[model samples]
Target: MSEVWAERQRRTNQLVRGIARKVLEGPIDGNRLYGLCRLTWITEAYDAEHPAYIRSTKIPALGDALHQNFTGRTLDEVANEVATQLERPELETLVRSHTGFTNFYKAYRNSAREWMLMHEAEITAIFQRAYLLQSDADAQLLGADIAALPSIPKANHPHLLMRPEYLLTPACFALDPRLRFPILNGAERVQSVLRRIGAADRSVPAQIQLFVGLIGQNGVRDAADLDQLGLTALDGLGRADHEPMRQLLMHVPDEGDSLPLKDEEDVRRLQQALDVAQRRVHNSMTNKLRQLLANWTLLEGRAKDCRYDVLVKGYDGGDNDLLLEVKSSVDSAQIRMAIGQVYDYWHRLMGPSSDCHAAIVLPGRPDTATEELLQWLEVGLLWLEGGQLYTSTEWLEEFVAAVGPKK
Candidate 1:
């Protein structure tokens, strides 16, 4: 594994161990306590399975143990019932860490309750960590990192059904490996446990909300999920229009210390955003030019299956039309491209029309070399300055000198 994956696993293992310690230290009630153990068992089974179906195969038996025999029962009673039904010596050993089937419930019941009530939040945090680990493991098995997985969509009243088969459908597994089962089994376990405990109401309990928040904090690992988290966070802060926050949220990792935003990925995203903004500005400039000019109609120009930004025609209707190529900025690259595009547009669209003219429009003026290049090409130049559009008199004079005045 790469160092990044290794670090991810190390952090996940640390959280899992911490959760286990917290669970052992608390006096959680039997049902809630066993719920945590069940979660652990589900995770272990999912990870250890070769064919992966063993995870779901065991769920029905486990559910029966929880709902029928162990409901409202003490921890000891639940453990004994599970041991009897499972009857697998190896399974008993696996669960012994949490269940302690060898010990009687009467010995620790009162003490457990006291510890649980005193540190409920801490105990819940343990479960939260477990849920996160499960999510991480699921993501790993799916050939994805937790930082890239999309967030679970919010439901007003999310169904808590423990349908492992549905959760581990072929489509889910197909995203990574065809043979991998339990693709999203961890999330299913969390949701199912919550519903089983009658905690699936719209007003999610504080503990459950904490779990969700933890997932949002550490679960998102993909661009879509990052976008969702950003939008959600922005909505919460009433700053939906804030660009910096959106950028930060989009790149921030779900786990590990965040690095400064100076990486190539950040540059690429910024460039993409800039390209979009520049295109919008270019289009707006085209529209403004259309509105400002008189006795001239500007439409999109297409020739030889190539499209130019604007095509101009006089109301008198001769072949003396003008072709305009708009650029977001007056860089050498944009200047070169604009000149070539205008020439091609005129050659292909206006064909043999000596009266046609071509111009390059930009949001800002270019340097001396760029201006000279346009003059040499005999192309007209129009640029924006101080919120006003201005035509380059020098470019017009060079155009007239080279091509002569319009007939």
Candidate 2:
């Protein structure tokens, strides 16, 4: 048996590694994938009889083969375990030091896109650039067009596939396994997250109003939901024309060491206001979706894939089925879950079932880490037969609008 501290550290390491693994390679289509990848790396040998692993004699245990054929303990486990060991206070240290992929992937985000160009270094450039290009359509004004997005020339840098500020399509990226990286390197990921979940804006706060022109057009119950949106969900890349304002509300906890205000009520009032505002946005977003989707199918439900989170899927006839993933999310896990659902949606649509083609929609970009949650899975940027992932704002203005707004 291992030392108690070592055992504790090992478990924590496993937890972190496991989450990162899911972020890089999940939607866990079949349990076989999970057993093969996740359980195989442990110190204990595989039972081989586990249903998830051996569905049939023909199915090779990629997990088992990996453990036996590969040398040394896997980095997926090693990097995380090492950090737990090296960091003092052991498990507690690891918990605090460890960051989920949602926060880490932003290092890859080009500055200022995910967060309205908030980076200190690029704030100046973003301001200048936004000024030069008043509208994304003003591309001609600056003699700049969206050049073909640069593809990842190397592995472990999938976020690089998504350019900043400018919008992205799923085809713009790939979901190859060679992109996998060690999950334990949180420090390295900081830069990646910053690059991918940036802080620049194409237009100022007022430009969000364009979406409002449709408030009455679509019978939006409470336009306040759009008002409540914080613009952060579309943090990495989007246009001001359609990004819902709910994408912008970020309630950062005050990290200051000193509480200068003597009145606690002041803080409470401020928080109360924010909560009410966010809730209105939340409700409005759901109501608007429900209103927009009443005719097709139920607008509220899980992806039939990841039920623990908010996801909606509907049956549409022909190649045009509908599936939506709802994430009141501020991170990339939403992206990963949406990716998995889209893959499954494709399979369900054209694979075994004869359902309509579907749409995999989300309220925002996934904050989940691509290095771990989306590993080994062939999840590209778009769905099979050309489906899309969108925030509530984008869905209302672009994809859903394609079908026309609710009367």
On lDDT, the candidate that comes out on top is 1
**Candidate 1, run of 10 with poorest lDDT:** 98-107
- Give the total clashing residue pairs for model 1: 4
lDDT of each: 0.40, 0.29
Worst 10 residues of 2 by lDDT: 168-177
Cα lDDT tens digits for candidate 1, 203-313 = 222322322333333233331222122222221222223322111111222223332221223224335324545545655665565544422333453122345665554
All candidates' TM-scores?
Answer: 0.29, 0.21
Question: Positional deviation of 178 in candidate 2, in angstroms?
Answer: 61
Clashing pairs in 1: 27-112, 147-221, 148-221, 148-222
